[model samples]
Target chain A: MRATTIHAPGDIRLSDVPDPALSAPTDAIVKVVAGAICGSDLWPYRGAKAITSGATVGHECVGVVEEIGGEVRDFRPGDFVIVPFVHCDNTCAHCRAGVQSACVNAGHTRSGQGEYAVVTQADGSLVKTRGVPHADLVPSLLTLTDVMATGWHAAVSAGVRPGSTAVVVGDGAVGLCAVIAAARMGAEKVVVLSRHEPRQQLARAFGATHVVADRGDAAISAVEEITDGIGADAVLECVGTAEALTTARRAARPGAIVGYVGAGHGVEMPVRPMFEKNVGLVGGMAPVRRYLPDLLDLVLEGAIDPGRVFDLTLPLDKVAEGYRAMHERRAIKVLLQP
Target chain B: MRATTIHAPGDIRLSDVPDPALSAPTDAIVKVVAGAICGSDLWPYRGAKAITSGATVGHECVGVVEEIGGEVRDFRPGDFVIVPFVHCDNTCAHCRAGVQSACVNAGHTRSGQGEYAVVTQADGSLVKTRGVPHADLVPSLLTLTDVMATGWHAAVSAGVRPGSTAVVVGDGAVGLCAVIAAARMGAEKVVVLSRHEPRQQLARAFGATHVVADRGDAAISAVEEITDGIGADAVLECVGTAEALTTARRAARPGAIVGYVGAGHGVEMPVRPMFEKNVGLVGGMAPVRRYLPDLLDLVLEGAIDPGRVFDLTLPLDKVAEGYRAMHERRAIKVLLQP
Candidate 1:
């Protein structure tokens, strides 16, 4: 079976690899319907993250259950499902606490291994839709597996409440989706910090009340201006860069919460300033399994169209171009049809 | 009017200073009956935080209102009260949200410089006990002004739920009080990290089930071992040191919460590890005004004796010695009687 592999920096390719099979009683084999590149993928693509040669390279997807192991009970063949980026047993103490991202038996599912990927704790990891979604809706539903859940987590963690103001610190798919999440969560004002015109427009479409093509102090001032000089009630750090993290910190009002979902890169938690402002920082990887059902419902009900994040799409064999387009900022997210 | 003042590092003096008068329409002048040296005072005495010569330096006190401004309605002259370290107007949006520590008109109250100290937003910043209590109950009631409230905030922010496990990371008065707070919050197991014999005994008396002498990694391992490798459900960071902060972070289970009330020193937030573990960090200066009523009731009813934090007591003239003892770590907290 053909799978995507990253051999080195700037060297992602679609190559023949062994097809995955259910190796555990709780595992289910998923036939990839649509997969996409995530912001985290850029870490390995840019060589910032250590990667072995010919390593499998994807952790987001929506697919159909093709096979199941003996212990798998909830899902059956041909069922459309959104697989959470992290697999969890769901019954563990942590998973029961709605922190499935930190499930005791949590593991990541990678798509670059083959057409079939084994999802551990299959009963808990996959959320099935009412039926096989239309091909056009597949990309958006696929994102429910990661980016959408992540964006939702960012909003939820930041404590974006009804009639509150929220500032999103990145303009990527996650940030744009955060705008949507904040809106859905009842934030009266959603501001997206984006310099890119296309991304800013998309942000507005997703419910951003304002767009500031600014960074750092300018961004903070912009948010404060919009919030009557009080700063945002919540700030979502969607980018892991130091500047983005600092901006998120400074843009929040005293006692405001900063929800960071970005993988730590250049980000450094500025302790003193955060302490003085009494800002609450809460975040990490998205507990997608905890949010999947609610988000999937929103998608099915047409409340959100996160697939709009995929500005470009291509066949699975053209995964390299998808990676290139994302890396070069030509596409926010690139959907790949298998 | 006589007041205590810090002339420089290691130098404290009590001398006559101008009596404080109402500086704002909402302000009130209070004659302090009791003021205590907090762990934060050591920061300036140790030269970690610079202090201007002859600056008044106490922030925790219980006093008798000597005068009230025209705008003060809820409080009046001759009222015995616990003054929150930070003054806040309770009507502000932040205060309405129960974060009086970050109130729109928040400001600090200085000790040492008067027979009278100005309490800003008198009606909101000072919470009067039901009635003037006997002199013997003064110390415990005074503690509700800051340390007790702070410890309570720490436990509350850490999400100490019934049947949960909680770890208090500090041997200071706040940490000892946190043991009480955790137990009061119904935590099934209360663990305290303390090497000091007195503190450990105090922790045990306050309901800590386990006492560990180690710091950081060792302490975390101890907690994990106690919780069957799952870590504590809640952690309170009561010491504002880098090591204590790290220890609190490490001791919490994935997705558990840490309530930090420490006035940060050189502490650096470990963003990556915290993110990976999905820990939630929340806390800041305690909104004493928010917790005063309940804590005062607990104290008045003899349900808790948080003032036990003050192992030593001295008259106002011996303020220098009190500061010296606390600065040199000879006392956990010192109560100054005027």
Candidate 2:
């Protein structure tokens, strides 16, 4: 099977790789239907993260179950499922506490690693739709696997509530989706801080009451103005950059929560100011397993179309182009059909 | 009128100063019945925080209303009252939200500045006991003004629950009082990290179920061992040091809350670790005005004795010795009688 591989910085290529097969009793093999490029994938593609030559790349995907090991009970061959980026045995203590990202036995499952992917703890990790979703809905549903759930976690961790004001600091697909999640959670006013027109438009479609094309001080002031000079009740730091984190902190009101889900990029917490404002900081990786069911329901019920984040699409053979489009900021997200 | 003043890093003197008089329509003059040293006070006495010569020092006091301005209707002369270290109008939006420490019109009212101190917003800042209490209860009741309320804030912010395990970082008066507060809040197990014999004894007396003399890794191990390796449900960071903050962070279980009341000093938030563990950090200066009434009731009911923190007492003339004693680590706290 052909898969995308990163041999070095700026050197993404399509190459032949072994198809995955069930390696454990609880595992299931899935044929990739659709895979999406992630911001985190940029880490290794840019050589910022350690990526071995010919290493598998993508972690977000929607796939069809091809085979199940003896222990797999909830899913079988031909089932369409949304696979969370992190695989977890839903029965673990952390998973039971709704923190699936920290599940004791959690592991990363990437579609780009192999055309046929082995999903561990199949019963707990795969969320099966009522049936095979229409091909057009695949991209949106694929998001439930990672980006959408991450956005949901950002909003939930920030304690966004009805009548609350929220500021999402990132123009990435995750940030755009965060605007949607905050709105769904009943935030009275959702402010998206982004300069990219595509992301800003999606943010508006996702119910952002206002969009500010500014960074840091200007962005914070815009939120404060919208919140009657009180700043936002919640600030979602979707960008892992130091600048984005600072903007999130500056935009939150005293006693407000700042939910940061970005992979750290040398962002030093502004402790003194955070302390003065009594702001609570909470968030990390997306607990997609815990949120997949509800988000999938939202997608199925047409409550939100998070897949709108994908602006570019390509065949799996052109996966290099998909990564390039995202890296160059020409697309918010890229969908690759296998 | 006589008042305690700091002349230098190690010199505290009691001398005649102009008696405080109402400067604003909302002000009331209070004759201090008792005032105690606070952990923060040591910052200046030990030269960690600069002090101007002749500056009044103490911020925690219990006093009797001596005079009231024309606008002060709720408080009258001769009413015994508990004065929160910070005076708040209690009508600001922040105060309405129960964060009085951030009240828009809050100000520090310290007895060290003068014998008769002016308390702003007498109607909202002062909580009076129904009547004058016996002299023996003055010291204990006086604690409601600061340390006790701060301790309560720590426990409350930490989300202490019945049957929850609580870990307290710091062995100062606030930490000792936190043990009492956690117990009062119904935490099943309260572990206090204290290496000092006097503080450990005080912690036990205040209802700490376990006293660990370790810090960092050992302290975390001790707490995990006590909780069957699950970690504590709530952690109270009463020490402002970075080490204490890290210890507190390491002590809580996922989804647990860490309430920190320490005036943060050199505390660097380990953002990634905190995010990975799903820990909630909530803390800042305690909103004493919000907790003074309930803490006073607890003291009045004889359910807690917070004054045990004061290990030394002295007349106003020996104010220097009180500061010296605390700075020298010879006393946990000092009570001054004017």
Candidate 3:
């Protein structure tokens, strides 16, 4: 089987690996049909985050169950499924409370960007489609594995309501998807902060009513100006940079919440401003598993086209080019066909 | 006129000061009927917070509007009113959103412990009762000015719901009041952390369903045991100390929110654990002005007895003793009559 592996900084390769096998009774062997590179993957490829020299990479995929363990009752061979980045039993206290990302018995899909991947907690983590749908819908279904679900989590956690104003910080795939989530949730105004022209245009196409090309303090000022100094009714922080978090917090109105889905690094939560303005900070590793069911339905019904985030695609063997394209900002996201 | 003044650390004095007068069109002269020593007062008195020598002290009081400025319309001479600790115009964007503490044109009542105090934003900051109430209801009305409303803010910010479990992480007047707030808000189980016997008894009397006397990590363990290791659905953080904040965050179940109201000192917000568990941190200085009307109605209707927190009383001249008693924990709270 060919799988994506990280060997060193700026080093991505499609290397031959052993085929995945079910290791537990709750596991299933998935033959990946489509997978996408994640923004988080850039952390290690850019040497910003330490990674094992030859570790499997990628956590977003749509696949067909090639085999299932004896105890996996809901899924079997030949079923098409969306694999959430994190696996959970779906019966833990956290999962029962709809916070599956914090499930006590959490697991991860092995070698997701590969020909075959082993999915643990199969019945609890995989959401099966009505059938292996047409090829045109696979990209949208693939996004539900991570990015699209994460974007929806941001909207829900920020408490986006009908007739409210929503501000999305960052213009990555997740941020663009968040624009769709906010619009779908009925926000009267959807403001996005993006300096990139291409991302901004896509954001507008996805439902952003306003776009700010400013950065840092300037971005905050722009958002404030757009909101008439009242600040956003809901703020979706899709980028985890300290500056982005600061902008998100400053963009919120008094009593409004900032729902952050990005993985934070070297970021200090702003306590004083958040306290004084009564702004709330919530959200984390999005419970994509919990949102997978509804999001899959939305994608199936053509209510949203989140797959548009994939601006480039390649054969699984050309995975290195996919990483390079995204690393250099030539592509918003790259889909790999296995 | 006699007003409570802070001379230095551990020093509280009732000093002769000039009689307060209407300083602005929105101001009114309040003839103090009741004023109480707050836990916050002890910060400066204990030297934890710096104070200007001879600065007027006390911010909680119920009084009669002895004189109204030219622009004052809703209040008039001899009208009984509850003066929120912080004054807000109540028409600013933040105020309209029910976060009066973040009001742009905020002010404070001048020397509330004195015989006559100047109230700014009078019409917006003072909630008038139907008439001069019976003496028995005065204490509860006084409480609405600060502690009771603050406790209610904690519960509201924590998103307390019917049948949910709530954990209060302080045992002071505010925390005890929070027990009542949580119960009134329909929490099925109200757990209070109180090591003091008297405060514990008071907490129980105020509708706390469970009392944990342990401190620090032990307290967290005790709460988990009480909730069968599931944690509280809502956590009210009435004390802003780092340890209290830590306990509050740790005691919340995944997806729970911790509403904090204490004036934080030397505290850092924990971002990692909060993000990991999807627990939200919110609340700050309580927006007491926004809650005055409804709380005043509850107090007037005898539906709540928040005044029970005031366990001691003294003549206005004995204001120093009132401070000493509260500082030494000899009294749960002290009420001074002027």
Q: Rank the candidates by lDDT, best first.
A: 3, 1, 2
Query: Residue pairs in steric clash, candidate 1?
Result: B4-B112
How would the docking of model 1 be graded?
medium
Task: Highest DockQ: give the candidate number.
Answer: 1
In Å, residue B217's CA in model 2 sits off its true spot by: 1.3
lDDT tens readout by residue for model 3, B1-338: 88988889988888988888777999988999999889988998999998999989889999898999999999999899899998999999989999998888888765877788788898888888887999999999999999999999999999999999999999999998899899999999999999899999999989999999998889889999989998999999998888888899999999999998888866777576787888988888889998899998888788999999999999988988888898889999999998
Off by over 4 Å in 2: A112-114, B112-114
Local error of candidate 2 at residue B191 (angstroms): 1.4
- Assess each prediction's global lDDT (C-alpha) against the native: 0.86, 0.85, 0.90
List candidate 3 segments past 4 Å from native.
none
Alpha carbon deviation, residue A43, candidate 2 (Å) = 2.5
Off by over 4 Å in 1: A112-114, B112-114
lDDT of 2 by residue, B137-191 (tens): 8988878888888888889888899988899998888998999999999999999
Cα displacement (Å) at residue A123, model 1: 2.5
Minimal lDDT window, size 10, model 3 chain B? B264-273
Evaluating just chain A, the predictions reach TM-scores of 0.98, 0.97, 0.98
Computed on C-alphas against the true complex, the DockQ of each candidate is 0.63, 0.55, 0.61
Candidate that beats the other on lDDT, 2 or 3, i.e. the better one:
3
Residue A34, candidate 2: Cα error in Å is: 1.2
